[model samples]
Target: MLPWIFIGLALFFGVFWFSGNAANILIIYVIGLTGMGVFLVLTSLTISKQSNLLKKAFETEKNYPPLLVKAILLFAGIGMLFGSIRYWQDVPFYQDQNFSVISGKPSSIDEYNSKGTVTELYVEIKGHTFVLDADMPQFPKYKKYEELLDKHFTILYLPNSNWIIDYKVE
Candidate 1:
């Protein structure tokens, strides 16, 4: 029961992690789907072990349905297949097309909002943009970014997909 609850929570987290991340699906898909696959595998293993123990103790296989274990394993396999597809999608075929950082001047910062002084930053690496995740409670927008229009920053991105991996103030 508790495991099911955690799985639900993971699914919710995956949703938030995937928000505004369609172009940069690697972060959410790789971590979230892999976690889902691992959880499914664990469920399969635990169910099998429990069934085996029950069989040995009762001297009969009637205690638990054998199909239950097989079902869990089947779901695990399917989930892992989906995860593998996402994991392999961004794999680079060329050196220059891999992860690269573009260092240049930040042209502008728009749509600025602050919550009682806390600020959230959005990074536009290549063409993809996403909110910079940080300690939310202590969210701080750098003065250089807001005050100076020509602040220097480095954008880490994938050349082929033109997806922004990350960015940092320089």
Candidate 2:
């Protein structure tokens, strides 16, 4: 059960690292770090007094040494820190001043199909094209591709990735 909890935490962070918004990532990073710190401090204070209680609470036959728990926490903390740093590096590019705006109804909306499933959505507005994928931050906002057709939309996007940073239906 202890190992399963750690595995679930790892997978949660892995998915969040790829698809989470920059602001959300930062918030989670802070919260996760703070929670880990508090847990370590509390555990250190009570481990000797409640070692048996802790073992029984976990309901596992095997005991997890304090060192192993600390190691796992350290590893998770490092992974969150790395992901936060990487997301922060791209924050400046998503700022309002860095984004290019296009205001008009989309001329064409294309969905790329792979194995009978839509893998990518491409929207052409004015003369520029923007690509959206499930993993992208902006994909959820424009997910209903058919609704976007012939509807006037003001989109702010990064020029390099052509990923929408913001959009307004007008």
Compared with the true structure, all predictions reach lDDT values of 0.54, 0.57
Please name the candidate that would achieve the greatest TM-score relative to the true structure. 1
Best by lDDT: 2
For 65-129, candidate 2 gives per-residue lDDT tens digits of 54456455556555555544543454567653576788898898888889987777777888898
lDDT of 1: 0.54
For residues 1-170, what per-residue lDDT tens digits would candidate 1 score against the true structure? 54455456556655644652554456555555555565555555445434665477567767355455547655864676575563455555222356766776544454446675434566454455545444433333555545533556676666544455666664
Which parts of model 1 have CA positions greater than 4 angstroms off?
A: 1-29, 34-88, 91-97, 111-119, 125-130, 136-141, 159-166
lDDT of 1 at 93: 27
In angstroms, the error of model 1 at 55 is 33
Q: Write down the TM-score of every candidate.
A: 0.39, 0.38
- CA RMSD of all predictions: 10.0, 9.2
